[model samples]
Target: MCKAWDRNMYKLRFIISFQVQLIINFKLIAICSHQIFL
Candidate 1:
């Protein structure tokens, strides 16, 4: 049971980190597009 719980926690951490990276990438793209428009 403990091992299963640890695995779930690890998976959750990975998903959270992945989402953060995606958000940062999106922000960068938006800034670049805005600069081009300006």
Candidate 2:
């Protein structure tokens, strides 16, 4: 039971980090596009 809980925690952390990375990438693209427009 402890092992299963630990595995779930790890999976949650992985998903959160992946989402943060995706948001960062999207912001970078937006900034680049804004610069191009200017």
Kindly give the stretch of ten consecutive residues in candidate 2 with the minimal lDDT sum: 25-34
TM-score of 1: 0.93
1-38 in candidate 1: lDDT tens per residue?
99999999999999999999999999999999999999
Please count the clashing residue pairs in each candidate, in the order shown: 0, 0
Clashing pairs in 1: none
lDDT of each: 1.00, 1.00
TM-score of each: 0.93, 0.94
Tens-digit lDDT track of model 2 for 1-38: 99999999999999999999999999999999999999
Clashing pairs in 2: none
- Cα lDDT of candidate 2 equals 1.00
